[model samples]
Target: MQYISAERYGNSYRNAEKKRYRDRSRAELVETVAETVFTFCAFCSVLAVASITLYMVVNGTPAVFRVGLKDILFSSTWKPVAKEPSFGIFYVVLSSIAGTAMAVILGVPVALLTAVFLAEVAPKKLAATVGAAVELLAGIPSVIYGMIGMMVLNPVMYRLEQRIFARTPGHQFTGGANLLSAALVLAVMIMPTVISISETAIRAVPAHLRASSYALGASRVQTIFRVVLPAAKPGIATAVVLGVGRALGEAMAVSLVSGGSVNVPLPFRSVRFLTTALVSEMGYAGGLHRQVLFTVGLVLFVFIMLINLSLNRILKERERQDD
Candidate 1:
């Protein structure tokens, strides 16, 4: 029988309700602001991608149509500045494909082994040191890689080429700025990217899987190869795709080592990739010549898109299998 005034009780209850309402309002406001920021960031990323695709299409399509896609893509001659310019890019396309394939063949095994060592074999201290080195490698600029390749690797290749071809009949070694040099440089440049992604993927394999494999009397190497790698195949595939993208899009480094000559892709012979071809003449090219360069860009863009789409489908299939 503690009697309270109705007015007093009503006032207290109203104050408590008001405080709860204020707290809820503040929380809602914060949540709304956070949601808005995240949405804006996502929108910006989409907008950027859309803008780039639109720009490349708008600028590149006219050239493809004007030059005749067949002539531009399949023609062997690429004399753009001659009196009668020929805008064939058959060899350029071949060179790009060959260089990328060579880089992949040379780089992937080494990168995978290094990643496995880092993820599975190395002790913590050793892994830390090597991981730091890999990170540093990834941080180095592409131009720096080009410079190093030019100054150091080129001379070594020149000597090797001289030794190999010296015995060949009627074949003389050039300066060793050739498809092989470009591929080697590209392999080195892509190593860090492949290693980092692959190591992360390998390391992400569940601890339980490793333990279970060990419980089944599997050796460490066997467990890693049989259990962990299979589980991480999707991620490894992603790393390979990323490496391919890097190799395909690289211009400056490849141009430096590739001799910038439009020739069929031969290991010891000078060659030009699609990227190098675009870089070589875009400055002075006019009229149809400039348009053809745009077409080159368009072809490159399409190649990348196709590669990504194919890889994405593979990843999805793998995911379904995993599930």
Candidate 2:
């Protein structure tokens, strides 16, 4: 009756214990491997950014010195084909700035309203349909936007130009490709980005916050404006930054609709941006011309970095205030 076999009792107990320890160690190993993989991915991202920055600096610095900084940045004369070549990017810089700014001014308000409607006001079915459309818009290639701008938008703008100058006797009509057309295209291109990101940010605001605001006698609009929007500032700011970045970096669409001419950044005036300047010239550019393109790239890079930094600082300050 008392058959206490060592084989069954002692060995079996030890074996079970060993199995438990092995299982525990395996879990820890899996967790450690996952952590290592994520760390490696993060390191790769940082390395990639660093590499690109270093490459731009290395290739672009020499050009800046070769073409005196003032002429590259300030002088309005950019005649590379003249008997005496001159390469100044004043008009190009202004066009890029004005177009991007105009895009922001035109696009941001509409994007914000659309985002608010989707996140806070729209019925579920309508919101889903609109959200899908916005996503589809974002996925469309820049080239397609350019082609559409060239074929459809330019004609409309040319007609508008003719009408406005019709009574002014023989004004050179821009064939619809002008600063206004470029700005409009950029605004459309930036809208989906701003709307999608902003909607997500607005949706992520905690439900409890809205409920609390309602409990305090706040109406839906007031709660959304006073509480939800403030909470979503970081994401909205991120959306704005990315939108501006895209507007600033967009060459294909802007070049197609902007008439590719160096001129003042008037709404209906034919103009060229920094991005367009590089894209249009780089195909055949050589020597100083080629090197200066690199400098232009550097300038664009610095502009993007500065915008990102300034937005991040502003976000941080806002966060501190909230805290």
Candidate 3:
């Protein structure tokens, strides 16, 4: 090889090494920056949740203390504007629970069947069309649902009530604005969510499981009911919980159809839910009334938390049994 200048050779080697080192440093810096950004995003989410929880607790607890927890939770009468105001929300709470239960009862079976059809029975093209319809249903605004219920379902309910209670003595029909109407609206609103989630879960079941079930001479229906459904129980349970949350927290739609009266949660009677109670009077309310609305929010929060915990526990127990 031709002899090279030592200085030149040394400089070239140093430059090459420097180039490699700079490249490595740049890559490491990019990675660090990316990691930091991801961490910040996660932190922001946690911060948001923590802040909301803290704010609700700080603002809501004082009213609960002032109002007396027992009276606020257990007593039936709610007269906030009266000279001697009583802040009882027992009927509100009951209506919320009852309406949600009724919605679930009416919605879940139909949703399950729809999901099963989409996942297993229906032709692919038909399933795709129906899936699109379901997504469209979900995209429809809650306010629109309320408006439609008010205009369409309300009249139908009024006619039905007229036929049923016309001969019954002393039964007043408030033009079909009642707990049943609210529950029906809630059922329709929650159907899309339940069906979509359950269908996804059902389709996610491993193909091998169904094949094995068939190899064991099980019928198609049997395979689905015993193997696929059981395997997908966690996801289905999650869908149900989501539906419950929606039903519980729904205000505008339920408020429109629920007649806005604080009453025991009879299907035919005008009633108010916890969410409606909060929304109905928050605008004009003052002082303790405002604070008590926060308390209602707090109580609703607790109910959601309890529902989540109970459902999670059930899912965990199911997982253990399956294992």
lDDT of 2 by residue, 141-170 (tens): 998999999999999999999889889875
Tens-place lDDT digits, model 1, residues 5-113: 4356787767777799999999999999999999999999999989989988998889877888899889999899898989999999999999999999999889998
TM-score between candidate 2 and the true structure: 0.84
Q: Sort the predicted structures by TM-score, highest score first.
A: 3, 1, 2
Cα deviation at 113, candidate 3, in Å, is 0.5
Q: By TM-score, who's the top model here?
A: 3
Q: For candidate 1, what is the total of clashing residue pairs?
A: 0
Candidate 1, pairs of clashing residues: none
Listed in order, each prediction's TM-score against the native is: 0.87, 0.84, 0.91
Tell me which of candidates 1 and 3 scores higher on TM-score.
Answer: 3
Cα deviation of 35, candidate 1, in Å = 3.8
Backbone clash pairs for candidate 2 read none
lDDT of 3 at 317: 77
Candidate 3 residue-wise lDDT, 114-221, digit = tens: 999999999999999999999999999898888999899888899999999989999977799999999999999999999999999899899999999999999999
